[model samples]
Target: MSAARGPDVYVGLMSGTSTDGISAAAARFLPDGDVLGVELLGFVQQPYDASQRARLLAAMESGSARDYCMLGADLGGWLADAAAALLAESGVARADVRAVCSHGQTLWHEPGHSTWQAGESAVIAERLGVDVVSDFRVRDVAAGGQGAPLVPIADALLFAAPEHWRALQNLGGIGNVTVVPPSRGAVDPTAGVRAFDTGPGVAVIDAVARRVRPQLPYDVDGQLARAGTPVAAVVDALLAEPYFAAPPPKSTGRELFSAAYTARLIDDCRAARPTATDEDLVATAVSLTARSVADAYRRFLPEPVREVLLSGGGARNPVLVESIARELAARADAPAVRAFDAVFFDGEAKEAVAFALLGFLHVERRPGNVPGATGARGPRVLGKLTPAG
Candidate 1:
């Protein structure tokens, strides 16, 4: 690989699993891959119209190549508008941005084999009149890795504590936690950082919500869940999911916990009780996210965790947050686990900030992935840059 000359201002655009909107952040870099300055300059949620969302969902549920191409172009246009809007709002010009690092919208993410997130870089470049660095996961997948927990590298470098073992938990459409151990021993107060995805964050919840109450886009802060009690049968069935039992070095997305899987759960719940309400289903789904996360920590990474720093859209839900805290508290030797100190600083824009940091690293020709986290063979350069042609 060739080294890259650093760019002064890089914009990172992210559309997480929630499919809620586009988040954009601006970041400048130093040679060491540290972000000199990162600001969530602006944000815009370009909602997918009913037809567009249905088409996207269908493509995700089925392997439709035509849908992939069509959605890619549509998404690229949406991204261009998002970038333009942000720049206009912030009074920054397109020419001022050195590059745009878009995480894009992940459609399918399979571990060692393949992962696809559509939104053509060339289209983004042409529409926005700026360079783009996208398809961020392919190189890592090619290197024989899970290629899913890419953000752990950013977490270790930008957020790791010297004297505390931290777990950065992101509860998006799918829940993933990065365990950054104390700089040392638990008692000695020093250990290096390590992180990975804990699995099944908001994926199950959102799926169940869409099915149980088509009238609602989500449970809305888990309000529906908070109104009902957890269902033991549903919880047990969810716990039996193969992904939960899988060891580390694994990654999954809509491919595993899709509408089909959610439908099955709904069927089972209905068979057991034909008159269950949406609240009951939402509560059960909430438990799935919380339990899976707690189980991963207890089963795989049992180190004494000092804090559970959270990000992503799921962190805003009071019901889910309380469940996670309660689960961690049950362990015999668990340390204190709290939400991110800067939790509300900008809930909508943190992932964009993360990608901004990644783009900075890419521009500096630095390895931005953690081997222990993403299960890669080793650190490698991420993102492919397209010049502003």
Candidate 2:
């Protein structure tokens, strides 16, 4: 297929595992030989209302076929709204947008077996009046790989550090890391990239926060965790789970750390220390996220990282960030940890921007998944296109 002929502008829509909201980014790509360069035009975050979030959580936990079917369409409309808002904010014309790429809300992700991302491309296409690319993980899973950490390709190509190995740790609902070699020199960008889910990001902490105070959606500013000490025993026992020890080319989701799991975690904390306060439980969850990330680095990373750039909702939590930095500080080769925004664009917009690049690749018929990161047998062009009528 010929390269897409139009303005280089593309919009990326993302609703991550956190189910917090839709993050939409409009960016312009400049292709330099085999490498692609991108400039962020604008970004918009459209949060799901209480009812919408509740419905989505229900679908994720245990929804009927009817729920899934309806939710997919509804989500598409929401994604379209996000895209429209982004374009409006960016002052980019609808016709100039070459395509809209969406990493639709992932409802079920059982790596190597099956994965489902709910959000109808047709709906996005019709609503946005632009070509839409959606469902990016199915191809990788079908190729006998963990269909996850798909943004590593973007990391390798677009976000690599100048002279050393860098780890792009996304603290979304689940923590996943993509370690990319430096972009300088004639090195193959994707050659050294490795990525996988470290474990729960802020999911457990958020669950505990809600349990502690019904109205609280999350432990805002990490005050709860900072005020309380982590139950070290609870953190250690939780990390002992087999997933943390498993080799890469692996992934996980709510299937393992569901609401029920959070409840059990609270029970474990209480059992370990009957006087454990709600803040302590929240602190333990934070510790679990921090320790698991450090453990993954020690056990799996192929190269010593020079820096770790954090992105996503968890990055906003100071206590979580400090915990991760502290966890890594003990290592002799500890790398500097900092928010992604300090070095690049807003951390919240990283995933959405990644999907925009993926969409650009799909339109160009180029492989998007990095074999090293996703453990796919080989590279493959991901997502299905839905042309606007």
Candidate 3:
């Protein structure tokens, strides 16, 4: 595939910190002057079975080098299968896709230090017979950035509001927010973009739910949380952690909000209220996610946001969404919080599509990272490519 050809059809794969499954999106991009238009051909989410989820979670917690080596190869095949499934669903031919952009599962991410995402690009290229783009974050991290919240560029180009600043909050295993200036703004569209991790998302809540009820994978639409009241004291204490106070251009993952951390949070919840039930613990975790997001906006957002577009798995949870809305309501000019799908395409497809955009940029020889968002020294084209055999 020559760079001059500029392939428009691409596939994006993302396995978030939630360690649940792979989200894949097949899209076609049309370049219209300065703006690029995206058509979502199809989207599919292939969930990891119980065994796959267990291995992934255990790898995140304490996998050895050999474990990572094998997991990376296995994950690539799984990712390839997902891409094939997406193409089959979208009715797109493999020969038509320009490249496959895989965010790969993030086994460990430590902002400003080092980040590692597994899934062998060679394996993907070999299996798919297409150029592969993987390891998109390391380049930004090498430039002294958080190497996270890389979706701001995509938000600015694809999802920015018409007139006001928009906050794109992703609720994966870890919560991250991107505040983007309007696409029609007078100044540089990306100049005002700022992003950072907002403490925990559903990671803690899911962990709590699974611990309390071994049979449950997650809160299941926040049912557990809605059934019980949040422990105010526990939420307050958790917010007081240094991470919430830390400023933007930062990132975090299971590294900070690990299973061990979740265990501690549950203990604190019980200690705060000896009579606290499992439902209460789950509610407290939800409250922490909601409060932490609102707090981050207050501390780091440079401009007032007119809207907050919620995405990822957490967006599907009404109790979590309602909690976020209530927390933001405390502000006199709180932004309207709504599902990303309501305003754009499917919420679950946002991240996958964002990665697809990144891959598009890579193929076009355009820089992918936004300096303001990632705190990188300057713009840099991310991802390493592996040509099809």
Candidate 4:
């Protein structure tokens, strides 16, 4: 269905698999009938306090019922605060905002079956004094589809260039790609979109970094990786993960590449090659991320991509960026791998902006899930809306 009207101003909050911080983006949508124009008014990151982050990480791996209940409320309040902080920082009036869309903190994601993102939308609504739209994945999953790569809906609506085929790659904890074709005369632009997790992005990298360098959040500028060497054997084995070859309309997150997963990988590397250093494991993780992305593109994208637009925290890492560019270059259908800046979009805040767009879609009563990306039976209006009291 077409968008009946623009959502005007709304705040979108995302706490990705990274579990580090919440990205709050204030976006204003200009009316365009069925296709709205997205304007990112402002973006602010609300980092989790160290103690909270540790608790959240624990809950993600395995947690008791009490822990889930408590953290869910706590995260909801955190998201509300994040949205408020974003509006204040951006100089947007709370009265002007239509809603706050929270992707919440994904605690467990089991693809086609069940997914859990802990954050109470009612709490966000009550605190923010704005409507809340959340729990976006369940509808898609209920329709016999993997509830993931939801950002492709944003890519198709906001970033599709009329000139070339572009792959909007998000190098978050898990690398995912939204391949958008050149907008061709409004014959259902989303029908051609292809999106899915490209595989490990920052997950393995960060896990190894935390083990080796507890003082740092991640490998700064990929220094550690640059100093180290990759074990191709390990990289190949990681690439062989069933998820990678499973085909599109697929999605993955920390569930598949948790800290324990990385530990297992390190153990396997040490078993096969006795002298694998911490740096080597880290570098191999980086390699695994880059190669997996390129491999997905080669196998799935039907059309030749003219450019690959990078986003997410991974974009900041020079080594990761260069590695991805190099991997793509080796492909027969090489495309220019460009930063989000190349397209004038702030890559780091892209996902946050994406959720804003999703909120806009929900406000307009338009379907947000791209069936092709999520393997859903059809497009579904994602998210549950909670009205402010």
Local accuracy of candidate 1 as per-residue lDDT tens digits, 191-256: 244555666678778778877678887778788899877776877877888888888877778877
Q: Which residue pairs in model 1 clash with each other?
A: 165-182, 173-203, 174-201, 175-201, 177-198, 182-191, 183-190, 183-191, 184-190, 184-191
Question: Candidate 1, which ten residues in sequence have the lowest lDDT sum?
Answer: 184-193
Candidate 3 wrongly placed segments (more than 4 Å): 1-7, 185-187
Query: At residue 217, what lDDT does model 3 achieve?
Result: 84
lDDT of each: 0.75, 0.90, 0.90, 0.87
For candidate 1, give the lDDT of residue 361. Answer: 74
Query: Which residue pairs overlap in candidate 4's backbone?
Result: none
Which residue pairs clash in candidate 3?
none
Model 1, global lDDT: 0.75
Worst 10 residues of 2 by lDDT: 29-38
Measured by TM-score, how close is model 4 to the native structure? 0.96
TM-scores vs. true structure, each candidate: 0.90, 0.97, 0.97, 0.96
lDDT of candidate 4 over 1-389, digit per residue (tens): 99665336878899988777999999887755335577889999988888989988999778899999998998999999999888889998888888898999888898879989889998999897889999998999999889998999888888887878889999988899998988757678796898999888898888888888889888988989988889888888878889899878788888889878988878887887798887887788788888898889888887878999999999998989999999889878789988997786678788988888888889889999999889999988899999998
RMSD values, in order shown: 4.2, 2.3, 2.2, 2.9
Which scores higher on TM-score, 1 or 2? 2
Q: Model 2 scores what on Cα lDDT?
A: 0.90
Residue 260, model 2, lDDT? 93
**Candidate 2 off by > 4 Å:** 1-5, 32-34
Model 4 poorest 10 in a row by lDDT: 29-38
lDDT by residue for model 3 (117-168), tens? 9999999999989999989999999999989989988887788877788999
